[model samples]
Target: MIVHKKPEPTKVPGFWEIPSISFPIHIAKNFAKHVNILPDVEYWSPFLNSKTCNYLRDIFLESMILAPVSINGLMDQSYGIGSKRATGWSLQLSDMLSEFIIPHLNEKFCSAKTSTDWWQENPKKNQAWLPVQVSPLFRFMKYESGGEHYAHYDAGFMYEDGIHRTLKSFVIYLTTNQSGATRFIRNHLEDIDVWDRDHSDWNRRALKEEVLYSFLPQEGSILIFDHRICHDVDVYLGEENLPRIIIRGDIIYQAKSL
Candidate 1:
């Protein structure tokens, strides 16, 4: 007898979804096995398994306990972004990227061809061709009561060596909290087109735009979106003793040559 599986739902051009897969059990299987660039953002859940999430959370907690509070970081008070007293530990180029992120991007998002074409069409002097890569910076953020992140955009950066565009932002929840959800602002097609331009101040514009969606904290679930999107964290309303914990990182891509 012949049987047929149900057809998947039609995905919006700028949106993609990968359903939940229990951690450590199906973690080896591709969570984003079937994914593509959506109209505005990409949302994938169950990216990290329970064991992996707990392991990283413990490491971050231990690091926070050992490190001294430093006042220097990315969040800008002038723009009203990030937690007022945010504290955490960080690691650049974690091994988890190769184990989890790269595979998903290549197999699911089909970024390989896209990166190659981008570099070929926009070649620069003294630069060498490179594959689409993800450089993950592991960050642990804890927000106390009343902490909030104002509307903002993740800006692209340039360096003496090369430029690094934050193509995607990844957030992994470490703690469950009712408040302090991350919110993103919706944009008109024209607004998105403007943001697509180089050095556009979309984050600043997000302050006055309508909200697209708000993501609540769910342990082990991963939220991914285009860095160009305008987003912020809501004020934490729970008890002072209860802090929201989150793992943050950026999927960086840029053409670099020797």
Candidate 2:
């Protein structure tokens, strides 16, 4: 007698709730757009103006022409990177960050005071209060036709100077595209039992089986989420040569113990 096997469980509708907020003001004009994001994800709309976006996109395109594109993700090239023929290029924007991004982040965004004032005004007698930090690491990502990413979490921030660094992942769309939205899982994949297997294998399976919350990639718009969240870029559904381009960075938080 043959025994009937139990069918695999299907993902439930609205199993994970994705919440978003609008930052029409307060954040810079470039990061002032209506955001579609996962719950707890921080959004700074209008992260870049049209002019800046165009300038950055041109830089990425020129780099692709000058340098050979490298495969992204794990060295194994699995989890949709190799299969979809996706490629990436990286740029170190420390100079840009110091000249432009850092000033804005400290003055207008995270903390509105200069380092001297921030330290002097703090309650700590030793002036040891930790301050906000931004990672110099940045990447310019590109995905052509059928290019995509499987579900995965970003790298965590490294500890620095006896301070625990908690990272917030940032991505800004630089290309005009309506189809290549980023998909984020509602909950952390590490907490789920289904993803207990090998990283590559489980990530690909989670892409198909997990509940996904998606955000449309708007030009100049930025999405920042806690690094532990699982996310991936959806397959490009538009024209072949028209690639989806984005700039990625990380924000590290340093907080004093209460």
Candidate 3:
């Protein structure tokens, strides 16, 4: 005897399954051109629309829990001086962001001499290096009035495969501020004195003349730079009621195999 079988249920995608937003071609070209000229830094204004920025800000403020800054598993105040919250691992968010930016980054870097010479280190003779993804977790940071981050370098995180690591760091500004600009130092890594628990004299070491670049926060804008760059945040001097809000993430790259 033959038995009738029921058809399987169709699966529905989650809320975060919305289509990835594509950056404008002209904006992408501009970003590439500026980065190519600057070599290690680029600030893309209005990368995300005001509505999207508002949505992210609302969600983060409502759902995420902020805590004192933690450094290397400890709540340290010497290095970073602000509150931070992590969105945890979200593959959807990571893929969305990566899809929006990776294509442009890959196209620009893979074809440009600036990337081969300055961005990447010891790349394989002829192998191709590509940006794979943005980090799965996004760190939301809040710097209240009088808060500041000392001079420091962002350390890259290695992927499970060991061949890839976070090559670039990015920050998305959610709120506009008159102060609290991100300052990049011109000194070499060896010459810069990074802030530590015992040594908190980064202010004295980071001279005004050594500042290579300073970017003020703009709502819906993003700043991207090499992970090796020495940078710090100037003291937050904005309104006491409005703190500086930013989302931080990294771009992982598949380096040419050694």
Candidate 4:
């Protein structure tokens, strides 16, 4: 007898789900003082091209220097230096990014609520606080040998019926080195023998159906896509042996209440 399994849904990018991982490359370059290029296409193009929007260099540098704080060090990155302490610069940058990107990202992405929604979440109950704002201060996660990330999906919305989802989650790779690469390590098919497809779970099973896209986000380059897709960073042991670093930030859009 033979059996069949359902085909997986195509992991397409969702524009309405999560925050679109894009930078205001165009607005920053042109600096259309008061013109509000917020809705212009010419606005986003220049941001991706280096020579055009180079002012952002200072921002990335500032973020990189400060990301050590929010970074969980060993826990989040799975490996790091002496101690696991968040620095002042880290906190400041997180706050600054949250404030600066609010209006801009809100304008670009299709989120349900704005900054105000953050205050309503009632932190005392959740314990988990969302970034009211985030900036490009995130850096590369370094790990020594035997470093690995357990799997978990970014939380999605759920109704009484257990129906929920987020629009998208975009990751901006400031740079990549060492052993970092988006990898999908699941059995393509079910088993028949030792040579058959013996499915193995690498990082646990928080993320079932997902796609990991390895991106090379230049100084201003960004990787924009869906958030519901389960993802994780691979601990790298690069031959160069340099500390892997990348600066990134995050934001979330909620559904408007009825």
Q: Mark the regions of model 1 whose C-alpha exceeds 4 Å error after superposition.
A: 1-40, 65-93, 106-133, 157-165, 187-189, 192-209, 239-241, 254-258
Candidate 1: deviation at residue 236, Å?
Answer: 1.8
Residue by residue across 1-258, what tens digits does model 2's lDDT show?
A: 111122222322111111121111123453453434444465665666777677667655654421223234543543334222112212224334324344444211223211111222234423223325445445567677766665666655444243434346778787778777777754433443322422332244234455566777777777766565667776677664777878776665444452
| 2 versus 4: better TM-score goes to | 2
Q: For each predicted model, how many residue pairs clash, with residues at least 3 apart or on different chains?
A: 11, 7, 0, 16
- TM-score for candidate 1, please give it: 0.60
lDDT of 3 by residue, 1-258 (tens): 111121221321111222233332122223322454356677777677676677667766765466666322125756554455543345556766776778767522433322222233433532455677877656777777776676766766664454566767999888999888888876544433322212222544367888787888888778988765667887778674798989888887765544
Can you write out model 4's per-residue Cα lDDT over 1-258, one digit (the tens) per residue? 011121222321110111232443332353222223211111121133453223333343333432222112222333333111112123344444445344544323322221112222332322122223442223333233333343323332222321112232334333334455433322323123212222232334324344333332233334333332333455445445543343333344433331
lDDT of each: 0.49, 0.50, 0.61, 0.32
Please give the ranking of all candidate structures by TM-score, highest first, separated by commas: 3, 2, 1, 4
Candidate 4 residues lying further than 4 Å off, grouped into runs, are 1-132, 135-140, 143-151, 156-170, 183-212, 216-220, 224-227
Model 3, poorest ten-residue lDDT window?
A: 9-18
Question: Model 2: runs farther than 4 Å from truth?
Answer: 1-37, 65-72, 78-131, 164-166, 187-201, 205-209
Report the error of model 4 at residue 178, Å. Answer: 6.4
1-258, model 1: which lDDT tens digit per residue? 111122232421111122222333225234543234343355566566667767666655554432211212244455443442222312223333534664454221313212111222233532332224444334467776766665655643332344433455677787778988888765443333332434223443335347667778876666766555657777678654777878666665555443
State, as a TM-score between 0 and 1, how close model 4 is to the true structure: 0.38
Candidate maximizing TM-score: 3
